[model samples]
Target: MVTPGPTSPMSPAAWAGRRDARNLRAPVKKSRRPRLRRKQPLQPLNTSPLPGDSGVCDLFESPPSSGSDGADSPAARGCSHAPGAAQQLAQLDLQTFRDYGQSCYAFCKAREGHFHPRESLALQPQVTAESRCKLLSWLIPVHRQFGLSFESLCLTVNTLDRFLITTPVAADCFQLLGVTSLLIACKQVEVHPPRVKQLLALCCGAFSRQQLCNLECIVLHKLHFSLGAPTISFFLEHFTHARVEARQAEVSEALEAQALARGVAELSLADYAFTSYTPSLLAICCLALADRMLQLPRPMDLSLGGHPEEALQDCLGKLQLLVAINGTSLTHMLPLQIREKCCLSPSLK
Candidate 1:
């Protein structure tokens, strides 16, 4: 739901470093659903529509159905029938898809590449260099399709990547999951969520919105609503503020560092590389990349420009940790575990 919306966007000058307008991380989970808390004064900068805001589609509108189409869900098709039966059905589906391709989505896949799987973090590439070729194959064309405002698309990709970090999806299902996640994200962020039928019509003629919605629900359930995070735009704000306040060598260094950080994050999209990592890790990667680019050998010293060193350091440290955890051993960790030492697994629980 959207409200009248705030006329004034926060200016970068107001909060240097950590509290900079651009650096404001999107509130995850409950914070995203707006409400007035007596303890927290309303910041004029908070402009996003509340989850229950008016003028948006009513929540009561029929949630997409799973049985509208004759075809069963990927789960049902994958397991309810026999092994060979699923493969046979998949072949039939693919053939049908070939006959009914829609131009809505531009198909992307590298002609040559490999998927490197680590022991605990099974499907992630160890380094961007090793994964660049394949990642470019998917990212280049896709980025072309979704331009600068593509942060939402990136969010969707990040969601899929994060889900893949702990959940073991089959290699074959990767495209399906990625596309479906995009569909889900579009529904959430876009003024008009594309019809589920449009996506299916592009992939294969036989499917329906209901089946896609079911798959989306399955994916959402698996991810446990952890996909949303403050985006690069948030970082850009803090960086802008830092640049505004710095002078002389410090100013040059800060700008260089911020640019470098952004470059690193841009590189992340190549392989959906940031997916396995935590939010904190992703933030670190952005900073570290910037740090290295600025030729700063040590962690950023926010005090260089009289910025709130404590808050800046705290935020940066947390962000860097997120990036480090993403591609490393920590990629295997989940948000919260539940019942019987089980993960509250997405599907097989």
Candidate 2:
């Protein structure tokens, strides 16, 4: 008897809203389209008087209603229609970011390529599986707890690996730099950038903004400012969406099975399973595996106990192979301490 997790009913109105994507409940007249609305910046949540209140503006501002003076606004006069203004601004910011990143990459490349090519240019004299495991052991828990998506974490790890493969910072500085690079990658990928202070706070003040900036420079110099590594979020999203859609025809239990399958797929992505496959292909495989597993007589629940145990075990196997391929250690993926606490032994009964 599997206890199902909370599920939100797919309401007709919600389904229709997803399809049309229009907010017609509060009707807007055609006259509003032509007039320009003033864009208001969101006020801070702290500014609000009510408890539990968050002051945030609507994603898109409503346009002003058109009257006899409709054409007189700045928007109507083409002030807001600059073709490349947004692009130009974005490019300028990217240039600045790239400049810092390239500087870091170049520094590392120069050190590894020229200064000490044969001197074990690895940030450490040696990075054994054990040491790698120890590092990831610390990193993974922190990352997951912070809600750092799997894909972003993968990119961070891969980026560090690529940089290390080329240029070796000292072992003492490696973790500091790795975390900084991860922070930068998160900022690049996530909608919200975790602030420097927030990260420093997490590290118990072991590192500072200046230190992070300096290390970031070195990493950028080594990698030539390349931040093009792939992430797992893309695959996770696609696979989850497809699984949800495919299971729509099934009974509620079947849907739960498939949804659980999707969760297993996501957890399986914990290791570098996504590295070999293109993002799209990885997405497909994850979905396929999830679908197959869910269609069983005793469907794998992906929950903490009972039938979900099998699905969880399956995910562990796949993740292990992926970690091996990427030359990463399993300390972060699954630690002995965690296994003991969860009562998950090698036998996995």
Candidate 3:
């Protein structure tokens, strides 16, 4: 008989059970029984050992049971499971959102004054209003290159203005601050934000990815995460929808006019003089100016955005000047048909 070898690390009962299970199999002839069989580790039933396993224990990790801790994920609970994409469109009712459009605009209109920048540049020691204008001018073309929505650009400018007042930014970092604001605004509204690498590439690698990310956190924290401010795009759409509903303009005409007005609004965004005007005032003036420039059969009323006549005229004067100054650049921003339809030329006027 072959001498019995040292026992396996398994419990006595477990070893006995294992021996009983092995005995049930066909007995090996002595000539075929290898000597090393006695020295090999006894593996538990129902499990094959992995190549590198030490085999001290045979317990398996299970998925994280929901509500167990209510916070830990499967990965946190010692398993590697990725979660599903979050549902941003859950519980949306398109008809209801459209139906409530006017009411939503009214809510924002009532809050417009709260969002207007008050002496916004007073605290920036290194940055000047001229610098602000130049930065926004560059940003307008950048926004077009990315094909971001007018709302995204409006939100970006709003975010930048709100954050600018909260901290004194260095002139050197103003461009970075602008791009960081764009990123935050895109995250708030766009389906896919531009990649950080791409945005930095636009800057010719003047800023690092970490610097952009760090400034993003600083902006979000400084604003206390409040980003739902009323914007020029919001009020502009409201006025256009109202005009269409009132039958003062054709659907297609209103759309074209709104596009022209959006270009006007973008032009205004680059001028520091226009920042102090409430968004509703600026939006109405842009729409009204667009309609007058287009010479619509029935132009929208100046009172549509609910500003007084005096404020309306004042804002309108500034918008007319802005349009006159940037006529060439604004024309480039619009569709060819829209530019031709609106007569920026003095002879046409």
| Model 2 bad stretches (over 4 Å) | 1-124, 242-349
Candidate 1 regions exceeding 4 Å error are: 1-120, 123-140, 148-150, 192-210, 245-263, 271-349
Whole-model lDDT values for every prediction: 0.44, 0.47, 0.78
Q: How many pairs of residues in model 2 come into backbone collision?
A: 12
Between candidates 1 and 2, the TM-score winner: 2
Query: What's the lDDT for candidate 1?
Result: 0.44
Better-scoring candidate (lDDT), 1 or 2: 2
Worst 10 residues of 1 by lDDT: 104-113
Q: Give model 1 RMSD, 1 decimal.
A: 31.7
Q: What is the lDDT of candidate 3?
A: 0.78
lDDT string for model 1 (183-261, tens) is: 7666666555556665565555545567666778887887776554445533343433433343222543444444445
lDDT (Cα, 0-100) at 214 in candidate 2: 83
- Candidate with maximal TM-score: 3
Please give the clash total of every predicted structure, in order: 18, 12, 0
Give all TM-scores, in the order shown: 0.39, 0.44, 0.72
Models ranked on lDDT: 3, 2, 1
- Alpha carbon lDDT of residue 90, candidate 1? 29
Between candidates 1 and 3, the one scoring higher on TM-score is 3
Candidate 2 local lDDT, 1-349, one digit each (tens) = 8999999899998899787875456665766457676699767455323444352332233334333343433234222211122222222233343446445433433443222112122345665434555565566655655556555666666566666667646656666865786786787776665677877777778877899988788778877776765344443433333333444323333333333333333443333333333333333344344444334443322331112445445544564344334322322333233222222223322
